[model samples]
Target: MANSVFGITDENGNFTIELPSWLHATPNLEKACAVKVIQLPLDSVCRLRHGPSSSHGIHLSSSEDGFRTYTTGWIQLQQHDTK
Candidate 1:
């Protein structure tokens, strides 16, 4: 995963994460491991963390099998009610 800067979680519990300066400036940068955009059912929400610092990186355990990827800046995640 690409190195990421720190992020802030608002009082409303909304997280605002920023990509590294290089990635931000060049949105077309090829995918490394970091996710550019993701939308999951509230039920699917598990744990969120910055990738590891040493080597193994942050371990993400999820019930979902995997994710689908498309060209950068061209994908839109549809929002639906999980209830």
Candidate 2:
């Protein structure tokens, strides 16, 4: 199984996620597996809601409680990018 990496967005609403270097060096994810954005939040302190779901890999959902916009995206190996 692939190890999971986690990152929180900075004050500028930017986040950086890094995978094991071995993945690229060994090419373990070339075509056998895909890098995906987990749709579900593993752990959250505040209220959370499931927003709009993506048919492809990208997930665009909204926070109905505050009407705030929450965006999530995912990518699959050998697949076209989706917005």
Work out the TM-score per prediction: 0.25, 0.31
Q: Which ten residues in a row have the lowest lDDT in candidate 2?
A: 46-55
Candidate 2 clash total?
0
For model 1 the TM-score comes to 0.25
Write down the TM-score for model 2. 0.31
lDDT of 1 at 34: 38
lDDT of each: 0.37, 0.40
By TM-score, who's the top model here? Answer: 2
lDDT agreement of model 1 with the native: 0.37
Number of backbone-clashing residue pairs for each candidate, in the order shown: 2, 0
Per residue, candidate 1 scores C-alpha lDDT tens digits across 21-60 of 5654444344343333232336633323422231222222
Candidate 2 lDDT, 3-71, residue by residue in tens: 656566554434555656665443323333333334433443322233323222323255366333323
Give the residue spans of candidate 1 off by over 4 A.
27-83
